[model samples]
Target: MRRSIPCLCLAAALLAPAAVQARVAQARIARMHTPVATLEQVQVRLDWAEHADSGQLRIRAGRVDAPALGYHFRDLTWTCPLRRTPEDGWQCEGALRGQGVAQRALALRGQGAAPLRLGIHFDVDALTATLAQGQARLALERRTATPDLTTLILTRVPLVWAQALLAQAWEGASFGKGTLDGRLAIVAPAAAPLRVSGPLRLHAAALQNADSSIVGEGLGGDFQLAYVGSAAARVTVAGVLHGGEFLVGSTYVALPPAPVGLHIEADSAGAEGWRLPRIEWRDGDVLAGSGRARLAPDGNVRELELQAHSGDLGPLAPRYLSGWLGVLGLSGVELRGGVDMTTRIEDGALVEVTAVVRDAGLHDPAGRFGFDGLRGDLRYSAEAPVDSQLQWTAGELYGLEFGAAAIPLRSGDGTLRSRAPWRVPMQGGSLTLSDVAIRPAREDAGADIRFGMALEGIDFGRVSKALGLPAFTGVLGGEIPSAHYANDRIDFDGGLTLHLFDGTVRFSELALERPFGTAPSLTADIALKGLDLARLTEVLGFGTITGRLDGSIEGLRLVDWTPVAFDARFASYPAPGVKQRISQRAVQDIGSVGDSSFMASLQGQLIGLFSDFGYRRLGIGCRLENQICTMSGLSGSAGAQDENAFTIVEGSGVPRLDVIGFNRAVDWTTLVQRLLAAGKGEVAPVIE
Candidate 1:
């Protein structure tokens, strides 16, 4: 049985005089609910106070206690002042305050004309939210002062519905100071699992760490999501993101400083977890493909098929990770190729990668460095017992339009082994390397490359030009046919027939050794059949020295790529069929280019001592060691000589000026400069 006594109290307060009405207090609630199934106590308190003169009822406080909802609120207060409007609907200016106030202690001011329209502010703080609904339509708007703050507005939201949202946090995830808004429509009445569909938009969002320190920016998107249950959902988005982007934080990775356009769609019906049928992304000039990425219940991608293609690989370098753009010092590079692969992780690290590529072109301004055809299957499993390796074989490769050749490589267990560094041996040439091995010699060791190569028809002049060396005219009319370099020593046993100095010459037995950490040494015995010394001198940019010059440089050591020591001698041999004339200036110039103190001193002495010295010839022998030229056999040694031991015509000029080792053992720089000056006919007389 229930008794009705609340009418008397209400009537007394309503009929009270104006002076006495100010002392009355009342409490009311427009709506209230207490579900029978809830075990916890639930109560909502709404209090109203009216001012006698203003004729307005203000909601002074509200208390909602729902222990089951993790909500126990106290100190609830609100103020709503009544005002007359032009439409004759009541307008209320109110506020809400509670113990666990988040967002802010809101100042809620609203106007009701059938359906309510409310605007809320967090005191004098920099935040605003507005809500408006009429019949079935609903809307919300929110803004913030923070530049990176995001706003979300939701409409047609069902009071009771279950849904799930999935996101891949490439840089980790944390809730930001962003507003959330979305519209969700329940397809049927609320049940165990409800089907919902809606459009969601998030804008101007920034990503921050857990402590609210900004880590990245420009993250926002609009997407449509459909959910059949808490375990089943689909999301599609189009937006811009900085830093890094990923799919499932594991399957797909697009590293930062390189922007990628993201598009993806997935479902959960096929397997236990989300199954992605297709996902396509374009980053910089690289196109990435992902197909059939099946996820596990624990949000791990179980399987993935992916590929990447690029037309420019310069942007993919490690330096670009730090936003450095000017490091690569080249242009006109074009790359077009793709990798087809699948990957799986074990123990939370990259364990396996199997991929292949074809028709890859790496280019520069000069020309294209590319692969004619590439076919390979590479695999790497860091945790496997054998620790799988990477192997590659290509049909052909072209460098700078020189030609095409095959390249085969095998790498495994921290070692890279190649069958051949260049080309396969053909014709009279045979390539063979014995026990060639290179590895880290010690801790902190850089790369060590040890290989031997043999070649045929390899033009040394062309090699010198390609390697940016001072041009030395050589015989290159025929193939080498037999040249081998092993243990850092190169030996050319075959001859090259060359056209030079208006005559044919043969260069044979040219051997050199350039050991690691040591200078190169060469030895060659030159044979001149009918070499024109005048033309040879002219081609060498020196004054002409006539007659056939026969010479041999034995045990020539060019330490540190510079000629240091050698035993060289050239004689003015009279040709049997031709009578050749030798010039005195040519004699001086050859002596200068040689920078041979012995030659210079001898020339001065012989010229001073002899008048009209014929090929009543001249020859010099020097033993060069420790950069010092030691002259020997100076008196009548193997050439047409004058009647006197050291004379043709005695002039008594400065005692013949025979400088014993003069200017010898000089620094290489001074010697080189002297040689160049002599070649240019700019030689100065020795001061000492």
Candidate 2:
């Protein structure tokens, strides 16, 4: 309606000269062209009574098209009463109707086939017009004294009414819901850039791009915008936005109920895209920032420089970081901190970052890891050397608690390294770290890290208690030559050694995958030597045995810290200084655990007379896979005469007792239950 009224007013002004000469007049033009619109088959008729001050006027056009403004109309007709004012200015007011005009103009208003009321006042030097429907109105004015300038006042106008105008600056943008009330001044000259400056108040606005990657909903704001369209266009907008949610790529922001201040200035860079000279954001004390950035033609950020601070990060994750945090499976993480940071990016890559932290802390409700009392000045640079330090009062990894340590760091040439070894106290021992180097992830590669660690005199008894294992006292001390982490996995170059039960236990080929993710996995191989079987059996609550034990567990795998597969073998062997003796209760328990039968050299009744016996050798092995344990014993083969038998104990003294196993395959879960029952003395044996 607003667009068509201007052309109608022009037609009236053109007929003014002829109207003054004749009381009744008719005129026709095959075609007419004006700066605003083009008309075909135009006709005008006017009737006046002699000595009257008003006349009946009618106008018709076969077609009116304004291609530059995205408006087209057919068979347009207008009827009005034209009156001459005391100042001799011509004024006309009436309802305008057309085929394409009413539909295109009222499409956004949802008014079906309703005529638009248009009123125009024109003198030789100045003109004003108003187009209205219901509560919505648009008024336009111009003067010959300033032909290139036009002033427009809008009241309760639907934002969709300017879709065509918005497309001139931002292609593929559509306004879904909203209304605007504002005043605008447009200066467009034939030889200069088209400029529009306005103050607009937006209410419940919603907008989205073609791909919906960028979107806003329930947005309200008071904004001042200045836009210039030329070969190198520029735009500036400053506003206070309240009660909205917007998403851009992986960043989603749910604006607080309170208003947030914002300002931006940008200039078009043609094919290179756009350059933003300044950006400012403020949301009370929760967040504040200023930045500059460049954007590619596809709307990806190419480069950025930012300096920002936050007084409280408690609400930061949900308000601004939820999209990314949810993607990384850390949605339940909580943070309480204060931080200030400065960062720079070049060519879509991060080049430098510096941050100061004040008593910041983070916790994961799932208990994977957490830290507290962190204070630091952390810095990273890709080109020049930089130094920094960070200290934490306490932390935890997995379920192990550790005391605080300070780390000195230096970075240059795209890599960061520790300046010296840092020691952390855990379980009455210290874990020392050295030669730590880190390379941050890039577009084409994941993060890379290498470090060396040494553990000294860690109390295994306390560790067992903490892990809910049976009591065993020893020291765990070892050095890992190097460890590397990449591609979501960590591999240790060396191994850990533990001293337990007067023996040595070594672990090698250790690797972990997805340590902080769902279903974490671990793989390792363990070898044991010279173990005191008497002590080991006592600690495990098994019947007493006095012997030296050796064992090897290879190809061990655990998922979620539960044993899934292994090849394990344990044996008791005779030694010069060691007694290879087994108690009667131990033999019974072994038979119960291994599903073996006893063969005594003496009578069964006589075997019961002995409380203990000496053993020559005792061995058992199991290869576990897919919930089944393939069992074997010393000198046993599948094709042997006693193919179903496997010895669990072999005695050599008078009235010797030989314990043999008949079952060769056992369910892993059932075997575990048997072992637990035996350890609890729940299995009762009968000698027959």
Candidate 3:
């Protein structure tokens, strides 16, 4: 029984081994053909139904692959369906794998849902790659229906070069509507250079390179560029910029708030070196031309040349380029002109420049008139640490007039030395003498002055009338031409003879300064032999002031544009036919108009000091100083017998009225106001 039992056990062992091998073979066949519900590493499990069911399948895997499509998935799990469609194509639907900073769940759809095309959508944030190879094209469509109004439609992008492709289109996506439509060729990792070249139309595009040291502005314009080589490599661009403005340093320059033209051709070397071949701009009536400005490796301007021009001077003259007064210390004046300038820059500073003003005009807003026919040349060299000297020469009076007198003038020359306190040295000029001449108009004062003047033949009445002064009406005619004021003091080295109303008078060497300070004082010596009083009274509006009127005004000054004290005397002379009753009112009016009357001053202080302030066969002498008049004699008091009369009525050292000739009378009210203003803080001892 033992031997028989051994034989039965041996038979049972051989049969058990054969049955185990059969079961293992069937299991292998099931795994090869059917989809698994879950799998890990080399182990997998399949769900088998006892009867027929739907072809839908659930898949879970640590790794999976479809060698037919060259796709691989790792650590993935998905629910999909495999069904045979009536068209004889298989259909699969399930969740696709997603990964990275971008969270994306791809919705897999095939021909059934794709309308004869397969489509996939991914909620991807970002993508990067190193290489790509494919002949098949891929198109992706993504949309966000809520939370944001962002929509993306992408097509024909390679996987290994995704990052470079996206970067090339970033600027176009930032302006206007933040949208971009363009084509680009990108090489990832830039083993050579990541070349990205394209023409992009932007709806809304903007760029901010925080890592860059310089900011790019006016980016809303049309752009076409090519980037080659490394991350900081060669670049070329050619396009027109419009509708925006930019700034460099603190100069805020803007386009005309409207559309402006821009033309550019630029190239760069490795991000740090660059040059512009030609850049031109045109807007309105102005044009600007610029040359290349290349940056050194040290980030400084290696070279630059920029120039601008405008046909109409009004636009840039007053605002950007103020001339003359801006150069001079004067105010309330502007200069208008066209410009031609060229500048060279090295190491970020202006090294040298040459500029010129073609034709310009000097305009005064205060109605002082203007001077045209102005042209000049200017040059500057910063290499010397000082502004370069400039010289200007001009000719012709474009349009010059003063008061009511119109004097024609010839050519003139001047040199403006640009030193510490710049100086203007003006030389030659000539003016035609008018029919009458007294004090020349302020604008024409020094026009025709010469070395020596002799008043041997000039009509004194004509002179007096032209100067707005009271007419002497005496027969004093002869030419007293030529006077000089170059040395600071006005000196008339001429003589005038007076023959009127049976009197003879003469003046020699008459010199005068406007003020006592800094100006050369006047020292004149005159002789009046016999002068008629009637004609003097008729012309002077005084009370029959009969006198020879022989005296000299020494130390005179009209420099204050006002008056000051001088020395004079008066004596008696015989004459007739002059008006007798010179009303005090008339005297006061004349004094106020002339604004330089001693009689006006005394009338306010000592009224009626002389009942009818007139002198007949009278003589007096006085010295004025320190605001006090030292009267030496009244009438015939002292042996001072000079027919010409002079009254020195002074108060605080305030100046006297600058009244020339007999028009020296002033109103009492006006005299008081002027005295008050001129003597606000000055007080002196009174002499009764």
Candidate 4:
């Protein structure tokens, strides 16, 4: 009987497991959903199934559409086998695993009734709500109308793990493996202010984006944010940046390392809705700036007191003013030496800027503009003009070198004006600047200026040599009463006059487009009167032609200072005591227009016999466009419609020689080659 009893007990013990397992029922749900469920953008969907006997409810194919938060959760499954811990409580949760920052393994527990209480956890410690592994502790107190102060406390959570929270703040936010440690209290009540307060810290952070616009590396920061009023508009924030390199859409600011920190304290109150009363930045001992700024009624910077000291301008320019410098085509401009400046703003306008640079020097990568040993004291005031003096030991403009000179300046009306006319020596002559005003570059691209220039008598001989052009003997002078600079373009309102070849040549309507950038353009209208052809031809080596020449070149455009297009015409001025003669070589050079057949019938063979011929008149015109030159001659020949009957050198007396142009349209490039060939004495007489 005892053996039988033991056997019965063993059999019962073995059957107990099967009996307990048999009582558990599992079911898959299908197409069962609760419409209009709240909790932001979460959609609650469940498959209908009756596992009521087993106390289990499985939810499958759950998805949340949160487009506003830039998030999508798919492939979601929740298994909530009902337990008797609470009469109407559910432990519905699943491993949310997929792409993006929302991927996580969570266990959610909640009650199925009103005034709902829900809790979600990733990795929790024995201490009920100790967050870990991107876990969050959330609690909400609610009523029939709305919820109040939904508290969310997270610890040791990856910063990027809060994509939904971050998406509500900014676009395309990318953060690194930094842990977020903080408790955030938020309230969303109807007809009440949305209040949020928290002490947040990001540790060991390195954040960057696909576009280099919002990039920060090795960033560590803390912010104590408190808001008891309406949505963000009335919020106060106190933040401190320990160290980092922050790049915000073309502007990059970086902090060095330890005690060198950057602090920000801002509030929304007073005359201005928001103002920064304590803004400080420190970079070791090399750079430091502390300032306060108040926002205007429209939320722009209205008042400010900023003082900056830098041991080197080389780094400061790139870190702070790269955007503005790039607009001025001065990127990669090297600057060195100590710089100190104090600036003030009033009503969103610059009030004053007191700056002093010591032993400063600049090296331009473009080699167009640069200065060395620059010492300057600049005091600019909005109300009254100040005495500012600028001195440089050496300088270069457009690759031209000049000695050191002190330039005096004054300021008013948001412009820096020259106090007196300054003489800049160039080409053994003086270059004077008067009425010079300059509006410095700012963030909004509010930079423009107007100035006047007067050149006394600049020798063109040295100017020609300096410019690498043919030796020209003339006195260059000009009066530009209003040279305006705006939108990267400079236009001269007056003209420059040149006395050369016993004549006058004037240039008007001159403008320089993108003066310091790629392919600068110069446009002007040039008029010449009563010019000696002998001296001109001798200087240009264009084969001696003795005659008084007058010409006009309108709409002349030069790109990179090289003539690209023009409508030019030159002809005998018909003045007293002027002999019109064309050298034999010159006749051959001009006859090369058609060379053989074009000049054959026009004394081509006879032209080679005379050393020089007396011509009744001489005329030449070229209308260049689209790389083609439309050639013409004197009024009589210029208007000649016969294809091969345009006279170039009209004969007067015996031993007559008449050179004519037969082709009206010629390739400018080809004509230039021909002209160069003729200049080299390569013109050959082709007799047919």
Candidate 5:
């Protein structure tokens, strides 16, 4: 075993002189201490025939400990024949056995348990030793002529054997699995810096730091490493990693099957920090980059500069960008593009960025947004003004497709501003954006953006069709005086206006949160005035009603575009120029949807005799919260005879018919189902 080699050499050196003077010689050492190791209960015996060329030698030790080297052995024994070569050099080769040798010793013992082989050759100026078990070998050589130098050769060696050596360079670093085949030269002189230089071939190697923030698995590489340990330590590594995966914080790299070249040179910044002066990575057509960075003692990046270009980004998402995409809630987003970029950071803040994009495209599989044919050069600076331009051929937002547009921008003093208004065509109309300014996020602040927008002649029919809603005819045109975005939320300063069914609809106090993330939410207040009820009902597939309509929806909130809470009220009032009439089918559908019963001044059975009815006024309202709708009708207060009864319709002609609802509170879902059934002409009237 490697642990006991030094003791064997010591025993041979002490006894070689005695062997020549006497045929049989023995020595017992209760305890012996050396600079590298300590030995206890050691015994040595040599037996030689008179005038013979060789002698029988045996050495045993109860314990050997080298705490500095992380080695401890117990019950060590070696039996070999000692010979004096023609050159007057000593040689020994024999079986070596020991407990607590290393992990490999345990593995070798489990596979048939053969004693290890140790061979030693030493002269006045040089010494060489080799320890082997099975097919694995470790050799050490030192020379008195160069007392400061030691060379080690390893063949089929388990990486665990170097755990202590690795810790000397990176404290608390541990080997998980793998093997090594390489050679190393160590220069460690008294009262001087220790230096190690080596070339190593690793197979399926794995390792992790104490906190597990840095991890590698299934790593295979051929590398050249040089490290110097001093007040300002330096390390250099150059290699080609063939296969593996590693994760450092939010950045995860899944190496390709083909080899990727890497090189880095770093100097110690502090007790636990590093300053990288140069770094290079090459991965064929998938990626290539070079960068320099400074890391703080707490492992945060303090300064960085990088220049990178990708020939193709189709494969970059799953392999290199998954971590960032997942953290931003854009997992599974697809990309096809080529990009070149340069970035710089100082004091943990981005100071400048420049990027050029070529025929790029991105699509979210969740159907939120998509963009194609993007060509641009974008430049940003925190200290100086920079001008840039960007253009996209087409895009889609919430399923509404829009045609191409270009944007000119200038950035300075940490703010980017648009130079000209942007007009995008959509659904037979245009959306114009102006007065745009943006500021990127900093360590202490979130992103801030402000913009103004105007909509002109947007066809609501096409909008409804695109959104899979009822085919309502209208024109949308509005101006948002200002809009601001910050902290993942957007707020509009003004409202949108739409002309629908010969009336005007307004949306105010509009705000949105997490618009592009999971579970987006929206809140707004809506008001409608003088809407043609006949046209509105016809588009909704409800039976005909000729009247004027007014409504308001307050405290409206939707999560994932589904109504969660609102107070909505709609009413019909007399119009001097418009006739107020309701058809029989409309009365029946309204009764069914409102869960009301029909009452006639003459008789309930005679209500079916009339094909239509005249109504002075009608109204309905509901305050929805917690999945319940508190229903109200024309009679806003409780009825004198029945507390729950409320008049839904008031008749004004002969044989007048009125609809009365007895239920005041209904499940929102049930009310929606009833409305849907009525719209489909599946509900029948109840007469009382």
Candidate 6:
């Protein structure tokens, strides 16, 4: 009885009008059910002549439930007058209104037959949906029991509006506002689950999230999805993103305004949630990858195998991987390389990485390092406890040039170590690397490094040129038993020896902090021995001083390549090769540094008459701290207990000059200025 009323009323409305006594007719359907939808308490009212063929029909106060779609509609009201049609079975025109995110406004028309048929047309803001059905499937178990439906064929529908029908929400991510237009077909079996399949085009679409994990603007693409069943459903997603930025963790990728193609196919993996047999991402001239992935039972990423290639890695770094590099204090650096790599991940962690670089170049504008013509094939894997080999052609670091090298690494026990010692030529010197141990990249503590370095027969002329230091000729050689590069610092355990000025200089307790950051710092202790005084004076433009020189400088610190603090003293060695003599100008310069006048063995009247003088001994010292220089070391100390007066240069023979220093504590700035001016021959005469 409930099933027959819709056909009866539809037939009556389609028939022609006739003259007869007026009567009102109405009936109610307790329930109407489809595989995907259900409507209850449907009321139908008819108002027209009893003898007439056509009448006004109204369906109101109904509710619908589509649990699979997350939709519940209440207060559903439909009012339309059905009339007899010459060619059509039954026709009615009015509105059907419901309260839900799905079809809210729909125009309904139906026909009466063995199986009912209906046309649903929906139109709303920036969206429209139309369904013209040929026939509706009836359930075999209850064909005549009540209103039951099984299948639907949508001839026309808007795709964007269909997104509201899907019950899905991605955590921490969302798509920006836009419209999608296209078509789709929905199939529901009485015994099987519902399925939706089609191609939907995104128009002017965009996406953004709080973490910027998936951000894109002005994006337009087409995506296709087809689902068969929930238990073992195999769904493949294929789409293209027009332009956007994509970042996963610290790895970032960018796209231009042009289209970027992507394809993926996933199949049920029983206990393991899903397995992707094919995956692809393509961006012309930028980046491309092909891969496969697996998901755990809980839908978390389990494993991934990918092969990617990049033509240029320089521009790709700043937009995507800058944050990761910043952890190592390498921000604002430029990187360029033709890169080819294969990465394998297992248990949601990176297990293997293999990469080959072609024509790689990295440049730091701050001038710490810049290298080109670099190439290498580097490999690391958890499976192979050892047996990794890396070969590079050449590189430059800190203005020091180096030759090619091949390094083989062994890995095990949570560390990667060099299988054998490695040696390379750097700036006319050989640098040997041994016992190099590096932590794995995947470890939480960060990939720190520890190694030992030995230098042999390195020429200081080249070193001076590399460091932009003042002219000094020497051979530098040393061995540091241990050096650690971790926590943004490089510290050495042993000393470095330099053969300079026909003598040796030893440096110890060296450390470099934040080598690539602003205000890089270096600290060390230095001991100088047997340096030729005449050559040193000539090279530094400090007038002239005879005899060999020896001294020690302690507590030396350099911030941003400038000496900030140190205690240094140099005295002429007693056993020396050259005659002990001091040029007149040298005395004047020394006088200027000491803030004093010249004292002479000759009478004061004879001092001004000598062009130069012989000196018995010469020494100087300064303890610099807080921009103040405390000076000491004068020949033949003053008999008086005056802190400011000390004899510096002791005269030997006739016309000998004795220099007395009157300032014990002097401003470093003033001393530096006086020394610079004296080197340029700008010192004024000192008369006391």
Judged by lDDT, which candidate is best? Answer: 5
Local accuracy of candidate 4 as per-residue lDDT tens digits, 1-688: 1011111222222333333456433333333222111112222222323433223333233443443224455553333332222322222222333233123322122233122112222111110112223243332222223324345566666666565545443334566656667777766455665567888877778666545556777777777776554233444556676666666555666564554555666665544445777878776546789899876433446788999898877777766666556667677788888888899997767889998989999888877788998898888887776789988888877665666788899888778888888887765566788888888756587578888888767788877776677889999888888899988899999899999989999999999998876789999999999999999988877789988988999999999877789999888866777788878777777777533222333564565566887888888788999888888776654433466557676766656656667788888888988887877788775433
Error of 3 at 413 (Å): 26
Better of 2 and 6 by TM-score: 2
lDDT of 3 by residue, 1-688 (tens): 1011112222222333333333211111112211111123322222323232223333334444422112244554333433334443233344433221012111122233321122222222311111101222223221223311112222322222132232332222111112344444433231333455666443323333223332334445445656554434455555555444332322223444444556555455443555656766655554455566776443345678877666555545432333323322233555666666777776565566666666766665643345554555555554543223233333222122211212222211211122332222111112223222222112223322333222223344654564456765555533346565432356665666766556676666666553222332555555666666556655654434434444544544433433346455655543465422322333343333333243333344543343334322344343455444444323323221233333322122122111112222333345446434332322222222
Model 6: lDDT of residue 195: 70
Per-residue alpha-carbon lDDT of candidate 1 for residues 377-456, written as tens digits (9 for 90 to 100): 45544344222222223221112123434444444443444544555432223233322333321224433444544334
Off by over 4 Å in 3: 1-190, 199-220, 229-232, 235-237, 243-245, 250-252, 257-259, 263-278, 295-302, 307-312, 317-338, 360-371, 376-688
Instruction: Encode model 2's per-residue lDDT on 526-627: one tens digit a residue.
Output: 999989999999988888899998999999999998888999999987767888888877887888878876777645668777788888888889999998
Predictions: Cα RMSD each: 14.4, 6.1, 21.4, 10.8, 5.4, 9.3
**Window of ten residues with lowest summed lDDT in model 5:** 635-644
Query: TM per model?
Result: 0.43, 0.77, 0.35, 0.70, 0.81, 0.70
The lDDT per prediction is: 0.41, 0.82, 0.38, 0.64, 0.83, 0.68
Error of 2 at 142 (Å): 8.1
Point to the candidate with the largest TM-score: 5
Is 1 or 4 the stronger prediction by lDDT? 4
> Model 5 compared with the native: what TM-score?
0.81
Off by over 4 Å in 1: 1-118, 121-222, 225-261, 264-279, 282-288, 292-305, 308-332, 337-356, 366-402, 408-457, 473-688
Model 5: how far is 470 from its true place, Å? 0.8
Candidates 5 and 6: which is better by lDDT?
5
| Clash list (residue pairs), candidate 5 | none
